[model samples]
Target: MFIKLLLQVVYITVPILIYYALIRNNASLKRYHSILLGIICGISILLCMSFPISFETGYIMDLRTVPWMISFLYGNISTGIILTIIMLGYRIFLGGIGMFVVFIAYSITLLMILFYFKKYSQFSFQHKMKSVLTLTFINSLLIVSSIHFIFGFSESHYLLFYTVFTFMQLLLTWLTVYMIETFRENDRLQLEMQNSEKLYIVGQMAASVAHEIRNPMTVVSGFMQLLYQSDEIPLKHKEHVKIMTVELERAQAIINDYLTLAKPQADKMEKIDVKEQTSLISQTLSSYALMNGVDLHYHIKSDENFYTFGNPEKMQQVLVNMIKNAIEATLNKKAVTISLSKDNEYIYIDITDQGVGLSEDEIKKIGTPFYSTKEKGTGLGLSVSFSIIRAMNGQIMTTSDMGKGTTFTIKLPQY
Candidate 1:
């Protein structure tokens, strides 16, 4: 009896597990395939039907309970209901004397599970384990009573049958849930590790290039400045000289961003007045905003005190890059707002822009080096900003709708 029960478990588990793995990558398919999966489950039950083992009690024992409960436990409500209906129809069509009794048992189990569906879905593994044990205990009692009354199991076999089947169900259900959860956790960790590897590679390359590029840039910048000052130079040529000087300065700035990312000076950390720093940044960007025909405004939620430990310069650098990005994003609709607020644990700086907002893919790659949304952007702005924020133990949260706008919130731990 035990071997038969174990064999049935293996047969049902194979298809169920394979189906779960195939649908794991596509969440939409998992949502849409529930009914079809249930139908497949109903069809799969033919294996048990063809090789049914009847106990001396005139009752047939099969592994229908595995899929019946699994559908409710892991699948959506529609799936569980459909599975119940299909299984009930199959049982009735098979035309056994215990068909009515099996239908009643299945109905009671489904109704009870449906009642706690939402609550059960929210339970942690430990809590769900306790609930599963309780439910299995209740089902064991029902099974014993049904066999004794409807199918008329002999007294000697009733206890043995109830004990064995209940134990098997409990063991198999726990194993299934554990395996699925483990797979989910492993998938999440693997993705996170891949992202970490990308960041490490980017940082290594940035460090290598920064020092090599900075020296030549300084030499070019110095010569360009000297050329600009020469009275012997033609005025038109000096205009070209000025443009070269400006482009050189921009290149120097980008290189500095890279160097700062590669070698963050940790010893410079100190408590910064977040509100004051935000105000200073806003004031500095005011001219830039006006020149671009964008209304940039800064608001302090209160004169509320908030302090965080970081290199104040780097923190301000992060703010500058983010605010500039916001300003640039305000392409035609020229309104940008920067705000500061404080909670018990963190100081919050929010920059919101009425611009062509980011798409989902763009948002994911916002801080990736060499990836940018702007036509002429080098994309180091946000990438360097991401590094600076991480060095300061802070987070940048952004939300955007494609045409509406974008909001960036910088969260830093309060000292």
Candidate 2:
């Protein structure tokens, strides 16, 4: 019985190991992946039930709930339902009065899981372990009680078996949850390291080439401007020079962005009034917004002044970049709103736009160098803004709905 039970555990653990190995580098699961996960859990359930530890006629024990609960908690709702159908169907096929008991117990268990399912993914690791353990205990207790009522134990030996069975179930559940969570954390860290390496390479390249590229561009731009103003040049030729000069200025701006990422200049940190800077940026961008036919609105949500420690100029730059993006995103006659508020520890600046919003995949790629949603965008503006905020010990968070719009919230530690 011990060896058979250990084999059941291997049935569960091996699939998990294989599945995670197959998807170790994936940032998110696809639909087929979820189906594959359901199939994996279902296989574990079927294997455990086929080789359950038998105590008597119509009485058996297996760690099936471990995989079932894992399916519901870690996989999607459809995956959970698929596992349920598979488990109960196989339980019936095994031909036991215990099948009815399991049906009742898991029906209740499914409801409880569904109630907590939405928030389970958001829980901390400790909370998740507690939740899984609690559910496993309840499930084991339910099955034990049902078995006792339906077919009473004939001796103390059966009772001892029940205790050991429950303990084994809890232990396996804990181990499985711990292993999966550890893998998830490790994968997350690996992804962050990969991103950091990419950023480092880009920064190094920028530092090496930005000045070299800028010098020639600046020289060309200066000559173009001279041609634009030269009386000797034909009017049509001067117009072409003007266009060249404008393109050069745009190129210079991009190089400046590269420099911002490559070597951020050290600035003296000062206590910055968040409200003042926000208002100043709103005024500075108001004309630009008007030119785009977008309404720009700014509001201070509290009477108290919000202050944080940062370079005031850089703070304004971040504000301008974020707010300008919002305005550009908004359609003509739509509104872009900026609101300032404070909590106990952080001041919040929210820039919202009434424009077609981003998908989850697109949102994840934001702030990546050279990634942009707009045509003619270099994508360096938001990257520079992110770097600036990080230097000031702040964070930029984004939330969006597909058809509605997007909101960017900048949180800076309060001073």
- Predicted structure with the largest TM-score when compared to the true one: 2
lDDT of 2 by residue, 115-205 (tens): 8655575455777888889999999888877778787876775678678888999999999999999988897567557756766777899
Q: What TM-score would every model get versus the actual structure?
A: 0.57, 0.64
Residue-wise lDDT of candidate 1 within 1-415, one digit each (tens)?
A: 6567667777677777677676676755654555656755665566665556566655567766766676777666777777777777777788877776676676677777878655454354576777766776666567667767876755668777777667876777677667656765686457446645666776688788877888898898899999999999999999999999999888888777666656655578899998888888898998998888899989988786879999988888889999998988896537899988865566778899998788765676777777888889888788778778877877777777678899898988889
* lDDT over C-alpha atoms for residue 76 of model 1: 66
**Candidate 1, TM-score vs. the true structure?**
0.57
Please name the candidate that would achieve the greatest lDDT relative to the true structure.
Answer: 2
Tally clashing residue pairs in candidate 2.
0
RMSD of each: 9.6, 6.7
Q: For model 2, what is the error of residue 327's alpha carbon versus the real structure, in angstroms, after optimal superposition?
A: 8.4
TM-score, structure 2 vs. true: 0.64
The list of candidate 1 runs beyond 4 A from truth reads 1-24, 27-192
